[model samples]
Target: MEDRLNRIESKIALSEDLLEELNLMVFRQQQQIDRLQQQIVDLHRQLASGSPGERRDLREEIPPHY
Candidate 1:
């Protein structure tokens, strides 16, 4: 029947719209994840290099004989 065909068409359109929205959301999330991963990698590299700004001293005391 024509009515059934129209209903099916409407459902298909709605499904397509939902799929498109979901795809965009996934793409945005992926971009955010990539950015975070890159930041982590850069931080790791900086830590591994032992940059002067990241150095710390934990000496307890100095001897008086020096």
Candidate 2:
């Protein structure tokens, strides 16, 4: 009767706490992913712009014997 009801209430409370913790963890991970994505975009922009000293030529990789 009352004892069974108490047990069920306790289980429901624990489940609610666990759900909140999982949601917070997922939110933090999403923030980290957003930051990493921004870094990738910045790097791509830098590579594409190729400012002076950052220039790279693929034709430089030729063997001396050729």
Candidate 3:
């Protein structure tokens, strides 16, 4: 019947819309993850290089009572 066909078409349209929204969300999440990964790499490089005025032998500061 025509009524049944109309209902099926409406359902299909809704499903397509939902799929598009889900794809957009996934793309945004992937962008954020990429940005965070880059930030972590930059932090690792900074720590490895050490900062100005930093002492390399600070490990010798352990108290005699230890």
Candidate 4:
């Protein structure tokens, strides 16, 4: 009976540790998601505002070797 109780206690401890690790992993992922979301929002604002300077000809973008 004592041996069975020890095994159960050990399993519980391991489960608690795994739960903590999983929670931390989820928190880090959420932080990354938040940063990506903010970047997307900033990009949208920049596009809506348009280019800051004079427009260039598309031909100018071609490589000289072409």
Candidate number achieving the greatest lDDT relative to the actual structure: 4
Backbone clashes in candidate 3 total 0
Candidate 2 C-alpha lDDT tens digits along 1-66: 999999999999999999999999999999999999999998888778885255558798787898
- lDDT tens digits, residue span 1-66, model 1: 999999999999999999999999999999999999999999999888887385446474566775
Better of 1 and 3 by lDDT: 3
Task: Please report, in order, the local distance difference test score of every candidate based on alpha carbons.
Answer: 0.90, 0.91, 0.92, 0.92
Clash pairs, model 2 backbone: none
Q: On a 0 to 100 scale, what is the lDDT of residue 33 in model 4?
A: 100
Give the alpha carbon lDDT tens digit for every residue of 1-66 in model 3: 999999999999999999999999999999999999999998888778885347758787898899
Instruction: Let me know the TM-score candidate 1 reaches against the reference structure.
Output: 0.77
Regions of candidate 2 where Cα sits further than 4 Å from its true position:
52-66
TM-score of each: 0.77, 0.74, 0.73, 0.83
lDDT of candidate 2 vs native? 0.91
Candidate 3's TM-score reads 0.73
Give the alpha carbon lDDT tens digit for every residue of 1-66 in model 4.
Answer: 999999999999999999999999999999999999999998888778885457789877988777
Ranking of models by TM-score: 4, 1, 2, 3
Q: Number of clashing residue pairs in every model? A: 0, 0, 0, 0
lDDT of 1: 0.90
Error of 3 at 15 (Å): 0.7
